[model samples]
Target: MHRTWAIIGGGNGGQAMAGHLALLGERVRLFDVFSDTVNAISRQGGIKVTGAVNGFGPLEFATTDMGQAMEGADVVMIVLPSIYHEEMGRNCIEHLRDGQIVFLHPEASCGALAFKKLLVEAGNTADVTIGAANTLLYSTRIITPGTVDIFGVKHSLYMAALPASRGTRLEEAIGSVFPNFTLCPNVLYTSISNNNAMMHPAPTLLNVARIEAGQDYFYYTEGITPSIGAFVEQMDDERIALGEAYGFIMKTLRKSYFDMYNSGDMSESDSLSALCKKVVAYREIKAQKTLRTRYVLEDVPYSLVALQSLAKIAGVSTPCIDAVVQLAHGMLHGELDEGRTCEALGIAGMTKADLLRYVS
Candidate 1:
């Protein structure tokens, strides 16, 4: 059966997903806020992605009109900035119909819950299943207006659904698009497993002098030296502790790093030289910089902020994460505390007893 998939945010990730879904013969619709990008996709039919899979075909539709793109979509994949999820959710509440499934690719916090709040505020009670993840499935980018490059597609993409009652149906819906949907126990574990939240802000804040110093930086592996990696690992340890306190066995950031850059363990390559060799191989295979670059700017606010909330709930000290949060605030010239904190997201104010029942 030919299914319909709408990819929100017509940037690199959206385009890459649209390309793969189209390749699977799904009716793909791509949308973005930028009119020029929409026009470019419309004119060129679709983006041309290189590596792993290569093909070009006319997108079923390309538009800046959210209603038009979502009116009949069976599955809607959102890849926008985390800050924008509320606005997008509001829009979706106004337009989403019954039986449609909305997927937040790498939901930072409880995006499904936030989105559900929007739906309730809109007085909509439609049975629209919402699913979210801790991280995206691929590292990809658009080199130009209509060209996308996928560096790597993850082996497993973890996800959880709102209400916890809709997880099975949500999994089945997304599995239609990508067969690698691994059902997480819930959103908390998925959120904790996100490595970017811990790694991104620390390095970006630490390397601000360099990033602002006008030197061209490479991938994250470039900035993550021994000492920096240790700092990042410390933050990751705090996150793991928070997860354990909350009763979720979250994966360690070091293990996730090994999966991404090495062989999933330092013991596999005990020396810095061996790790460097693995990093070189990672760079040589593919070099798309959208998600890799946004990890700091984007993940810090959403993911790190959530980590801080979890840490507070668990009574775990997160000095490193706190420092990075402050540093990110200075770098962005805005207080992330306003929108990135638990209280800001309408969750921190809840007591532990309340949170357990809520997320549960």
Candidate 2:
């Protein structure tokens, strides 16, 4: 079946999704707040995709107007950074219609919960079913204004709806376009399973001098040295402990990479750095040239800080996680705060069982 798709946020991930879906013969509209991006895409007549997927996906329309982009769409995919999740949610609340599915391409952590909170706070009862994926379906980057390079697509990924009851409906509605998603228990499972949080911040923080000095290096292979990789492993341990406190068994970052990319076998003796160096898709990916990048800004607040908040609620201590959060705050000059905390996500005082029941 052909579905009408409204792709919000015309950055790297959004362009890849809109272009790929259009290549599949689905009717697609692209939306972005930046007029420059909308105009550039419009001038090009379509998005050019290369590498793993190759095609020029001609969009039905490219506009800055939210209402126009979302009008009569069956699926709305928000593919922005988690920092913009709330802003996009606010922009979408007034435009959303009933029976429409709102999916965060990859909700850094607790994004669907935060978005659902915004909808209820505004009293917009549109019966919208909101869901989120653990990670993006493709490993891609934008080559230019209207062109993208997709390194690879994931073999499988996890997704879940806000209310546990709505998981089936969301899966059925999105199955035609996203058949690789495997439905999990609830939003907690999806949010707490975020591996980007485990991988991005520590390495970026450790490589601050290289980034500021404009050194070009492979982010995963060179940026993640043996010690940096071990530090990330410690943070990953805390993430797993957080999930345990909430009664879910989350996969380690190394194991998750193996599962998602089918990269290679994992020996119990392999170090995190060694495992990362073996991934073929990550070989050509370059490190950030500046300190003011998403690796720190987006992941620290949305993923790391948010995980710390969840850990506090679970009564689990995360010394390694806290250390990175503190360093990010100090180095970035207080810009990173307790973002998407329990209070912000509307689960402030809930116990572990209470959180389970709330999502259930």
Cα lDDT tens digits, model 2, 78-184, are: 99999999888998889999989899989988888889889989999998888899889888899987899998787778899878799887777666567888898
Worst 10 residues of 2 by lDDT: 260-269
Pairs with backbone N, CA or C atoms under 3 Å apart (clashes), candidate 2: none
Model 1 stretches with alpha carbons more than 4 Å out: 260-277, 281-296, 330-337
Q: Give the per-residue lDDT of model 1 (tens digit) for 1-360.
A: 677888898877788888878877889999888999999889988778777668885688899999899988998889877878887777767778898888898687666656766776789988888888777777897888778888778887688876567788776777656777788766667777776676566766676666666665553546666777777777878888878877877767555546656654455434332353356444443222332255555677677877777677667788888888777777666534344566555565676656666665
TM-score to native of every candidate shown? 0.88, 0.93
What is the lDDT, from 0 to 100, of the residue 71 in candidate 2?
A: 95
**Model 1 pairs whose backbones collide:** none
> Per-prediction count of colliding residue pairs?
0, 0
RMSD of 2: 2.0
